[model samples]
Target: MNAIEVENLRKEFKSYSSRSGLVGAFRDLFTRNYKIIRAVNDISFTVKQGEMVGYIGENGAGKSTTIKMLTGILTPTSGKVIVNGMNPHKEREAFVRTIGVVFGQRSQLWWDIAVQESFRLLKKVYRVSDKDYNEHMNHVIETLDIGPLLDKPVRKLSLGQRMRCELAAALIHNPPLLFLDEPTIGLDVLVKLKIRQFLKEINEKYNTTILLTTHDISDIEALCERVIMLDEGKIIYDGSLQKLKETWGEGKQIQFTFVSEMSLDTLKELTDGLQVTWKQGEQANVWTAHAPSALLPEVISRVVNRYSIQDLNINEISTEEIIRNIYEEGVVHG
Candidate 1:
């Protein structure tokens, strides 16, 4: 079953022009003029059961707007959104009951209340049975490693600690679908790893369908099998991560460190047919080629014959770079 389905989902708002002066403001209050802003413009996609999908775009690219419509927070001006076979906007309560949402900038927990108390409140709101609530709480607490933080007030907890609690709270009802919006934002490396692991576990164990929106490419790489790229309120790219790389990321880098200094002119001449990107401390030079694997041996031989070799490293073009390039270069599909 498709966990979420959207067809031609478009949302628009009337942005009013505010007047600066008192007289203009008074006039505006009586005669308000506005322009139409299309926050989400006729975008469509479907997420099946047990699938992890990444929705990414720049600021004002309509990622959050799409998510809000899907979760039934904002009603779409046109088009359709069906979550678990129910129109989200019309059946808000039923739709919400089957899904969970976590926003990094927002907190559903009570500020002065302990984390445990917050979880208890969520349990009641979701109408989770005592037996199922305990089981789900134990599972999430163990997976997120937030047992130590349960007694701490949410206001006093660290960002990482609070994030773990938030995840635990979102999952206390054992919902089948989860929406995570920048769940790892402002987290340290260790905490980020922990949250990623927990997300993977939940998806695998429960076959929970997930739609994640994050600026962190690592989150997409580590979690999503499919990625939907949005730009200017449109779905620009929707496909596997590997296909995106193969289409746009065609170059790799070969970096070399020499034992002794070499003249820049001579080094440039030696490494012809490669784009020299950087040099380090008179000892290292980085070059880019269409295919590093095909050119590594020949490049190394020429560099070694001219200068003493120290260390060398070759790396494929990163996914983050590829996505950025696509956005800049504007990759369009029919």
Candidate 2:
């Protein structure tokens, strides 16, 4: 059975048009001047058990709206949202026990309490027995390396420390499904790496079904194999991450260094057949093109044989580049 299922799920909000002045502002309160904004339109997808899927989109593209609806924070304006065979909003209390959620920008922990206190509260909220809670809590603490921050109040802890606590808090219940939204938003590199590694281990060990929503492409690349891309509240693409690359990411960003000097004319000649778009530099050229990494060896061979090639480096097309092109050009072209 699917772990989560959404059928033509949609969410609409009102963009209220306010008046300019005090009198107008007061009058506008009663005036129904607004436009219907479809934050999520015809969004539908299913996640299999133990699958780590990336739910990605730019800001205001309804990624958060879709997650809100899924987690029962907001009732959908229309359509169905079912998680683990139950309605998330209608069966909130029970439904929550089956899932764990961490919103990086928002804290579920109480500000006045110590980080450990927040975990205790979650344990109580979930009615976790002492033995089960202790087992899971200890495991999470070790996995996330949050033992040091346990006594610090939620407000006093650094952003990274608190985020670690937040992650531990979410997993205290040992929920089978997890939702992480920008979990590495402001973390430093080391922290992000640790978090990524911990998450990968948890997923592999427990078969935790995770839906990660992140603008950080590295998170998607490291954690997810499938992606459900959103555009203006619509499902723009949904498939294997590899296929997304093959379909619209058949481009390489190449950097070339010359033993001597080389001009754009020389670059043009060397990469004549390659669909190249030069970015910058002359003696050292950085260019982007609709050529995959597979084409790099030949390009390198050709340039080396003709020009005084000193050094050459090829970067595979990034997830950001592919998604950016999809958003900007409004189409995914090969």
Candidate 2 residue lDDT tens string, 1-334: 7989999998888898877889988898788588999999987789999999999998998988888888999999999888988899889899999999999999999999888888888888999999998877788899888898888888898888888888888898888999999999999989999899989988998999999999999899999999999988898899999999888887687777766665667677778887665554543444333466677777777777886655667777778888987898798322
Leading candidate by TM-score = 2
lDDT of each: 0.85, 0.85
Candidate 2's TM-score = 0.85
User: What are the runs in model 2 whose C-alpha is more than 4 Å off?
Assistant: 19-30, 256-274, 278-312, 332-334
- The residue pairs found clashing in candidate 2 are none
TM-score of each: 0.85, 0.85
Clashing pairs for model 1 are: none
Question: Candidate 2: minimum summed lDDT over ten consecutive residues — where?
Answer: 281-290
